[model samples]
Target: MAGLSQIWAHIYTTTLVFFSILFLELVILVRAAAGSIHGCKNRPITTTQYLKLVEEKNPACRYKTGLRMESLECAVCLSKYEEEDEIRKLKKCNHTFHKDCLDTWLQQDWATCPLCRSMVLPEEVVVNYWRHQNYQEFDGSDEELIFLLSALHGNYIRRFL
Candidate 1:
């Protein structure tokens, strides 16, 4: 059991490194979940709000009588609009798409127009939402933190580290 003392030192170093890595990884995951990955600053919106936005931002309805509908193709699906097809116009860029298609696109955490890549929502709206959201850092305490913390306030950490 003469070599047992050295083993304890090795074990302590390994444990410290593991906990540090774990804490960093948890921080990364939390930020990613809040829609901060890849510099995506687009403000996320809810489905209910989208209903009002469509009408408020303005929408284009292609009323067909005898004219060719080829000019009214939805950029999203790359298909021609029919009489019953719902149309939504983005007020910013004046680009239009099928309502369902645009909704699907927005739900993917992107707030830009599919064709022009312009912001679908206004800057003020995003700013206001961001203020309310106040995406704070993940400060929640967990088992890893607890374990590392306990090791810090004396006893095992003081003796081993």
Candidate 2:
């Protein structure tokens, strides 16, 4: 009878653990789904904000000893990072690259680390990188001009069709 009680206790403990794990997993899944539906879009930050975020996200870039390491190479320029060079590091993956290089790369629709291809900004930024091109690419055209250009593209498409 004692052996049977011990077996019963073990079974009860196992079942309790299994249910706990299932509950945690369900909570996580629900949270993830909700986040996907309501996550904020990413936006372009000011130069100072960008620099601050880079420093906050990446601890490795905080120190500069005026020496270049053989292992520390900028994937964008295919060159080693000079100690004097400003470096930016991705937050999640912790991959580092030259600040200028990564800045140019992130100007594209997708803001991803060159090496890991992970997003350069955290998901919470909620900025639409794809629609946001390089600021320098804009010509300060009026809103009417933009609308006309879009209308022209549609008309051309119709003519071709």
What is the RMSD of candidate 1? 9.2
Clashing pairs in 1: none
Check candidate 2 and list the clashing pairs.
40-126, 41-125, 41-126, 41-127, 42-126, 42-127, 43-127
Model 2, poorest ten-residue lDDT window?
131-140
Which predicted model would earn the best TM-score? 1
Tens digit per residue, CA lDDT, model 1, 1-161: 75897798779767876786677678678867766653434654445665466456666565464644335788999987787677777888877788888877765544688988888776655454444356544354676555655555445554554
Cα-based TM-score, every candidate: 0.44, 0.43
List all candidate RMSDs to the true structure: 9.2, 23.7
Give candidate 2 misplaced runs (Cα > 4 Å): 1-70, 123-127, 132-161
Task: List, residue by residue over 1-161, the lDDT tens digit for candidate 2.
Answer: 99998778667655654564565567667865765786544444454564455456654443276544434788888887655677776667767778777777765425677776876666544253332324333233555444443453454322322
